[model samples]
Target chain A: MKINPEFVTSVITKFIREELNKFGFNRAVLGLSGGLDSTVCAFLAVRALGQDNVLTLIMPYGQTFPQDVEDAKAVVSLLQCRAMIIDIQPMVDAYFHRYPTDNPVLKGNKMARERMAILYDFSAREKALILGTSNKTELLIGYGTIHGDMACGLNPIGDLYKTQIRQLAIWLGVPEKIRNKVPTAGLWPGQTDEGEIGLTYEEIDKILFELVDLRRSRQEVIASGFDPKKVNLVWEMIKRSEFKRRMPPIIKLSSRTVGHDFLYPYDWDK
Target chain B: MKVVLVQFSPHLGLLDKNLDLHYQFIDRALEEKADLIIFPELSLTGYTLKDLISEVALNPRKNNQLNRLKSYSHKIDIVVGIVEEGNPGLFYNSAVYYSKGEILAIHRKVFLPTFGLFEEGKFFATGRNFKTFPTPFGQVGLLICRDFLHYGASYCLLAGKADLIIILSAAPGRGMSENSGFTSSEMWELMGAAISRFSTAFVLYCNRVGFEDGVVFAGGSFIYDPWGKCLLRGPDIEPAFLSLELELEDLRRARKTWSFLRDDKPEIILNSLQNLLAKNED
Candidate 1:
């Protein structure tokens, strides 16, 4: 779906400012992976809070691409915000050395969680909120690791689809090299998001825009010319990932449960 | 008559803080010498309050915060939104009209939207009536957010001979448009224009701005003349104070040129509704 980048930019910047200000935080920390999503978040965070207030952490594993690292550094220099490069290999390897495994998924998840741990650690170290970078497509398809890449104090781009984030990137004057680069999680060498997910963001976002946003049924989506297999796949992914989107369900023994009935706005009395 | 629209964000569940904000804006409006000032829906209690609704609900007849707001009306009229604690347990999303240091009228929101990002129906008691009250400016009719979407609600006000229809909303921004502004806001503007044109009443819409739990309120408030022409439009997604002097003559001229109100057939509609309801009961 098409979006007016200028309007999106204005609203998102305001959202960043207000969401942070309400929590008595003027600074933010985010894991900048040199990908389109994190880079866009970094730009918006800088625009909302000044460059001096945003801290970007580049956490790369041993197999992380060198170009991605360079791109992350380039973005930091371009935005002139604070940046720190912490090689996550030592921490990750230390954990895996005791319990070795070659499963890429498990190793990738460890890396993701490792980066998140550092982001939160610095979140307290700098007294800054953790800004999230997960896009709607990834979130909908269960592509992110829960409590890892999925965790954040506030998400500015969670509502935007991956395709829309690209559109926004162009409008925000993101570096052409990063914008045109093939999307990747940089979890391992030769890994691409589309290859791992088995669907391009363009295809996934279109399917999701119909299935989730427009609330189209599976048959209806298929009738609209999407492959039934892909539609079902996307549908299954959404249903499976529903748990990641919500807090852990609490068994209700009290009159009012925390998430079930004891509802209170997050910014209550702030 | 000069009217001021205060497009602001209210802190969630904080009555004293939001009341102080109202005083600041009222003071500013007084400095501008405006005849009336309006705030958005739940201006004193932020939207998206679930259990906090009861915690923030005010007893309009006895609350010190509301009385303080009423005191400001002695200098200039005030229209603000509040969670009115009705009977013992019934709480309504209500709008208060204060004039001459008294509570002139209260319009509890008739429509409580319950679907999709809104749980108002679960927390608020449904309002049962729509009535227009007299003010120094004109016969002013008040409606909350979802009430404005229901054309029949405005029709009731039109039937009551409302000269000015004021809508206070904390509508969240939804759906992106091709050019500018949210698509949901376009719907509000469309309704405002159609209502003003058909009823020949000055439509003044005041909407809030700011994010509450990630849902941003669209703040493109506006004023429309009786001819359905926009008099003033507020900024998008930002809090702003908008003021305009109403040309009361425009209302007279519009009503004269358009016979929509004069040739109205409320009796026929009422009789048909009576028959329909009778048949439904059968």
Candidate 2:
């Protein structure tokens, strides 16, 4: 379906409002990454829960680039949502110092989880639901940390793509600075999205829409005139991370299991 | 502060008998004056409800047993499974967060497992969104079995920012593992370990024990602190309760000591995760 952004926002806001009431909650919380997804979610949340009930946290590890911080502040200011910046460098440094791991990936992951911990702490105190900024692409690929950035009570953009977020960003009138900022995980200096992924989001999105939405097979995909390697690569990720999408395998000891047997989440009937 | 987890071997296709067992277990916890008491998933009704969930679902406004449990809420908070009427749906495996006096929260099972011998998808609909509820004693999160397995559950609780995650489970099998009779207990252990490590949230898992429909539950109720260290254990095949005291001071210290959620690199992971998402097809 070609969803109009306004229609989506209305449905999402309605979802948020009804969900909060249904679950006996009113407030919401989210980390403002100043990126397209979070920026878009911030605007959506402001519309959904009102700016006053929405608290945006900017968790910057000491090494965060100045622009990223500025952009985060810009989004919060433009959207008029409650925002705060919490420096996480000291906290992250302590873990590596104690364990002494040189693995940058592990350290980077540690940093991400720490940011979430702080967000949770704030949420704990604030009594708010964590609003997620993850879009469909990241969730499907298991791109976010398990409990870090991947953590949220509900994700608004988890079903959208990087390019889709960009579309929503422009539609929502996100500041040009944030909308145009080089997408980075902000792990270290001079790192960008293309550097790590080896393909631009534009190129990836077209492949994904066809594969995911159109349900095209590899031969069909290449037959349609795309690089075979890209098709193979994307398929491999889906095959590998398939576990991330479903419940972990549970050995059936009971007739019903939460994993393999009896499965359910809380408050589903509504 | 000590909590008792009763990993009971519930009778199959039995709700009234199982609830009677719940009363017995609660009485035992009260005998010990345990601060919190927990049970496995769907203990009130058998796990694999088929269609009986709708028939047996408790009407909170009318059900005497549920009301009795609500009255019991004043003594200790109970996290047990029950079927409740939900909007647009027939039944839910709900964790009625009740203390001795009143019901604190009602968490409908959201992640319906639909694979293998289990088929929750046939009955229960997944829950919407929820937050961690604050009790007088602590900030708590209630996630039914598979909910604990998903990143979504921890994310939701972590997003609500819960300090302690109580996973009321009916997880079966303790000795069987994947790939040619591997040990399933190890999987549960590793899962419990990873969940605690990742979220920095104290963890509690109460699994059922019994033999029904050829399914054997090895009741292994385990609790881990924020650092992924085991705090207590219960028998693998008994309708018994295990209790332990947790210091809020210790939790605060663990949060200070383990800063996993605070130091993250979101921008990079997001790119790597979604790189293919925006890709074009041939």
Candidate 3:
């Protein structure tokens, strides 16, 4: 009867801790994006591994919004956790010059990947688990950059939808300003998520829930006026991005494959 | 209970030929003092039977074949694949587990492959759930080739449910590789791990060999312990009977070393599988 934020956070935090213990890992590292998703993950990680155990890293491009940095600082200060802030603008610019692309999506992707490279470098240095912050909504829509914002040793919020992210952020006590900020990657100037997509998270959330959570077909989704084009857009995105969800597609040269040919997920060598 | 795996090759549409081979295997198993003998998927007729399967399907009420199998059940249990004759247009690629003078259980193949070299969907329907039949040794779970691949079957079996997982496979050699592909090795390992990690139980995979309609049957039959350790594996191209001595202590030792059932995140596993399936469905 009581659907509350703390209840969700408590459940999520306990599960992560138990899974880590089961996996035989003691500490975890999380990228502190200063966004709602990452803030919630940071809070959960703290409960899972303690303030001393969960290292927070804030990697900012020099071009990143000032508010984003302020929010990252707020998380570190409030959680009383150790954090390292690294400016990647110079390094990313160097690569960008070589790439020479006007495409924002491609550029944003490269930045995301660069941040992950730094995150992994820190993970090796600290010997801590890389905790991912992408929520189910972003993952489902293929919104986050693969091997970038998507790279992590384990994901905690990968199943929760975007609306669920807002709720959990409130439960985790992420600062109101960051929580309410137009869910942006802070990839470019004058950018809000809906500005590029032409539809707000609320609408996307409703359509996605109706389609996936409720198991509605394409026709049913269209009948509901969720925009046949948008539904098709989401479908195409998922189809094209499936490669990201799985291991490199099996090139079957043997009697069986790990994926489709002789399919099984268990490691036989063990 | 001593479980005997009758991993034999079934020629296409040759019911009497396959049944005769089954009779020989069953007789040998009985003489060897085994408590039960199991066969691969579609053992009465091979997998490539397709539409012809429904025509040859023995009507259940008027079936003399199953009634014949019931006579032998007083001595030992038998789990064999059969066409459980349904209505005129419907029949199941079913594994009929018979014991004590009656059919104990029937599990239909759920993951029917519609694409690729196989076209099983044209012939049979998918089963809805994992069915477990009780035995003196433990509750036995039955599955066809693709049914075992559904890892959710592992969770359902682990809920203090089954002690033996009997898989009847005409298991084709498709995308299995040692490192990164589909191979018979992957299926064996997954099934072994599922049985081992889920609880104290033995997994028996009886896969047929030889080509059926150009689909090469990979004859890698095996039995696994509850710890997921391989108890036995037969040759990849032969009709062989593989066996392992299973005792309460053996099950107990596996349970002690790693109590996977005790440590399982049932709720998490449930959610993860759902999300995994949902993605695939999309």
Best by lDDT: 1
Candidate 1 per-residue lDDT over residues B72-141, each given as its tens digit: 8999999999999989789999999999999989999989999988899999999999999888888989
RMSD of each: 1.2, 24.2, 17.9
- Report the lDDT tens digits of candidate 3 across residue range A88-141: 888889988887889888888888898899889988888787899988777777
Candidate 2 wrongly placed segments (more than 4 Å): A268-270, B1-53, B56-282
How many steric clashes between backbone atoms does each model show? Answer: 0, 75, 23
Q: Counting only residues 3 or more apart in sequence or on different chains, how many pairs clash (N, Cα, C under 3 Å) in candidate 3?
A: 23
Question: How far is A111's C-alpha from truth in model 1 (Å)?
Answer: 0.8
Worst 10 residues of 1 chain B by lDDT: B176-185
Could you tell me which 10 consecutive residues in candidate 3 chain B have the lowest summed lDDT?
B175-184
Classified by CAPRI criteria, candidate 1 counts as high
TM-score for candidate 3: 0.50
Error of 2 at A55 (Å): 0.6
- Candidate 2, residue B146: how far the Cα is off, in Å: 29
Clashes of 1: 0
User: Model 2, range B39-69, lDDT digits (tens) per residue?
Assistant: 8887787675565567567755456877666
**Model 1 lDDT, full chain set:** 0.92
Best by TM-score: 1
Model 1 DockQ (Cα-based) = 0.80
